[model samples]
Target: QIAQESEPGLAVYALAAQADMYRWRGDHAQARAVLSKARQLAEEKGLDFEQRGLLPVAEGITLAESGEVKAGLRLLSDGVRFLEQRRAKRELARARFLLAKAHLLAGDKPQAVGELRRALDLAEEIGTHQFAVVEGQHAVGLLKLGIAQGVAPCRALAEKVQQLGGLGAAEVRTGEGAEEGAASRLEIYALGEGRVVRDGHTVSSSEWRTAIVKELFFYILLHGPLERDAIGVVFWPDVSAKKMADSFHTTLYRMRRALGGDVVVVEGGQYRLGDVDYWFDVEEFEALVERARLLPPHAWQAEDLWRRAVALYRGDFLPEVQRVWCVPKREALREMYLEALVGMGRCHEARREFEGAVGWYRRALEVDELREDIHRRIMHCHAQAGRRSEALAQYHRCREILKRELDIEPSVETKGLYERMAGKGPD
Candidate 1:
């Protein structure tokens, strides 16, 4: 009360923060009241745009989560445009994240994906994590997406986010509560073959009529609801425009018929896998990883998550359906797999279980034997277990791989580790 009386300017921000806290805790009525009071206080204090502009964005997201999509979106869009006009680079990431999450809660995953991509781009453009760790859900989603899209910077940031224990607020699930109750009728596996099991029956490749039809369906299910133009370019880049359009409609129609009328849906100008009783292995695998990521670093649960994640990978993503687009996603998931293996090793090492750590490191090397760091870890683990001979042998293997694969010598650190492990140099 004293601070409010002495500094109403500060009081406005405090009130705004209080309102946001209420909103996150499912207290919409209290959030609205506090937000209104904050806005009123801002106005009474004659706060300028810098001090008060984002209040509307925050308020819009709050209302949207409370069953007012259009009204909230209108205000949110206006606020975003205001930020755009001022070129508020950093703030745009947070604003767009809020916008994307609102779309997610509104049952617009396609647009949510688009908005999430934009937010990640904005963060990338500024060369910052952009407070992504705090944005847990969207930021981590982008990290996973960006890696699949082969956006190199996302890897570094994603690693930081994972190590720090992923961050985010509770999801706003309105229609999704109903979705969660539906019995999953479709089992779509993209990890190995692009396999589909529909209505308790496996869909054979010959059932698609056209060779590309099943592939098209798999593409949409895994990476869409994509724009028609975007889909056309990926599938039929050289075909005439009219032919591409015809093939697209035909494929889309077959996708819906074979999957179901409501499966492949068009909404908000994008073709999406609608609210269906479906399960994708990729989603499950990523979910396991994310749940583990949410735990504290070196916590016991993370290694267990890696075990499930490794078991679920089966093989490279969509290997039977060879498409240009599948490569990055395959690599991205493989990258995550490698990281998980290393994570397991780190967890074991943290517990002073050196031999077990070496085992996980070897598994990572099996995936990509050229990883110098994993080799170093193996050496360190062996040395810790008082196995100087094994440590020396692993170093030689690392040096040979470097020479054979990339034709480069080991880094100074790697050599130093080997020397220290062999007790042939200063510890």
Candidate 2:
């Protein structure tokens, strides 16, 4: 009442919050009445945007609570879209969360899960710029409900939200170890081969009950946290959403059971593996490369960092996993590995260690045989070492590889190197 007496906007916000509480308690009539009053007040004050934007969300939740699922969902969707168009991300996230609630009330578990995931993602995104622990708490609640109802992925999501909320609202930040803020006790190797080592002990693959469970575990590791729907699309592409959801839950259960409860943490709709401290080889590799980048280009320490980073790539990333999703990540990691090799080569070249530089350049070619730039470097290294014939031969290999693979000749850069080695300037 005091809010209403003071600022009309404050009263509107307060009324909306109250209506939300009423809806949560299942007092649909009271929620609707309160929201209607709020709407009326906003309308009287010409608060069209607030009335048009936020009131619909409140009324939608009220309608959903009253068992008007279809009508409620429609209004919620429209209201969310309206706010989305207006770039009101916080309001959109809130509306989506409410829509998930409506889906649950409507007995559409799959849809509810999907909507909840979207809400959580949106909330996490918003939390990056603004603090919103309330959204994290709501995600935790919904995930708990999912667990109670026997949805497998929720267990991990609940843990993730708890962690995000625990480390303050900002912890929901994605990418580059947001959940695993500090170094972790769990060490996983997905580069070359896939392995999960706890402490110092390597977990045997034989212990994984099913291949799908193992695949699911690595998939989450590679992609960080994932939503149930996304897991469905990737792992069970041919199955219906309902069937895939069931299969995904079953696999997730197996994942929790096999790896331990804290192995994977699901935040809202995504599954991640960072309840405790954990380490992934690929992540470490990337981190090492990133650290080297911070040093001066010719810094001597970079040689060691690049060597250590390049050495970590035992083979192609997750070669055992034949999923198409792994391809891009594998390619990306391979490129990073090759770049590390190039960095090491450059470091050696700077020191005039021609043999060592040639070794690194040749190793780079083994990974990416089509690198004309590396070929050029190798030729330079041979020429510097007084291996004039070997230098000329290296240029020949470059020309042949380019011709056969790309059906194109070597770049003018390579031809110029050969001409310089032969004591003939370009015409």
Candidate 3:
């Protein structure tokens, strides 16, 4: 009906509406084409700012659905700026809705929620039914964000979704419920190549008798066989020494029995996993670290090995377990992982792999924001790659963070690197 209106300036609005309809129907290519025509027509006619602002948003939505997520996000952000400039609440809300979806697809849920909340506020201001519908969809996204943050509201949100008849209710329910179930289960992982099966079925360590035994196995694999005292301190820190030792012996006996007398040994008062064809994931991660550390400096394989090591670290070491003994080990392993990332970034920088090095350095910073060395490395990599603008931006960002968080200045090395990049120092 809107498209049938024959008014001169209404054509662009008509095209935008049609494009939105197509977009909702999952015909992204057609939507993009229509939006492109609308944008061109709007510009040629010198249409009002309201009609002109929808083009970038429609393009962004099309690009996101077409697998150009990063580009789509940038475009949507641009569209939001234009809408805000015009103070067009309706167009702004629509653009923000698209931006939220784009960020959600990019694994940036926190940003998505912020955009969605703003969109909802605009929707309320404009009294639009479409915004109300999107608000309902945003609820599901909010539920996902809650789950990712490990908040208790995740369960409540899931239940609310079940009651509301939203599109992703089943998915949210199943994904969160499955995660909760797996989290409660005591599973042991073998870290190696090839498949191992027993009686034509894959072997599972969850069939073990107790959670403590499984935990002990995980610890040994992660920390490379701790002494009895260390193990006692970690898992049973609050218990009496005698009770802790007794509990450790009991858990060890169960683990040994579960492995069927074939795969565990005690050597020099330290319990070790026996030589087995299959390796645990933790063991494989440790081996990768060792291999990367042992590689000749500037070896081509070092970055590849380091990437594999980083990939294996799905989250913090044993995120499910939070004992006093585990905290130090977790922190230590995290530091080691961040350093490995820094090493890989430096290696890549030396080889002129600027983008790859940037990725590694960014990941290192994500893992340890306090690591001034990584900040300097990132600044240096950006500068050396002829990205002087980005280098300057990074310097400002580091300076702000240091001032705000630590009340300090950048190190002399960092200042020197920045000065060189800015062409203000020794050539």
Measured by lDDT, the strongest candidate is 2
* Model 2: pairs clashing at backbone N, Cα or C within 3 Å: 156-265, 156-266, 157-266, 157-267, 184-277, 184-278, 185-277, 226-271
TM-score of 1: 0.56
Q: Candidate 2: worst 10 consecutive residues by lDDT?
A: 174-183
**Error in Å for residue 71 of model 1:** 31
Residue 337 of model 1, lDDT score = 80
Candidate 3 achieves a global lDDT of 0.65
Off by over 4 Å in 2: 1-184
Model 1 residue 196 lDDT score: 81
Model 1, range 322-386, lDDT digits (tens) per residue?
Answer: 77887888899888888778888888998999988988899899999988999999988887898
lDDT of each: 0.71, 0.72, 0.65
In angstroms, the error of model 1 at 373 is 0.8
Residue range 226-342, candidate 2, lDDT tens digits:
777877888889978856754665566445434544566556657786556677788889999999877764797898899899889899988988879889988999999999998
For each candidate in turn, the TM-score is 0.56, 0.56, 0.46
Indicate the worst ten consecutive residues by lDDT in candidate 1. Answer: 172-181
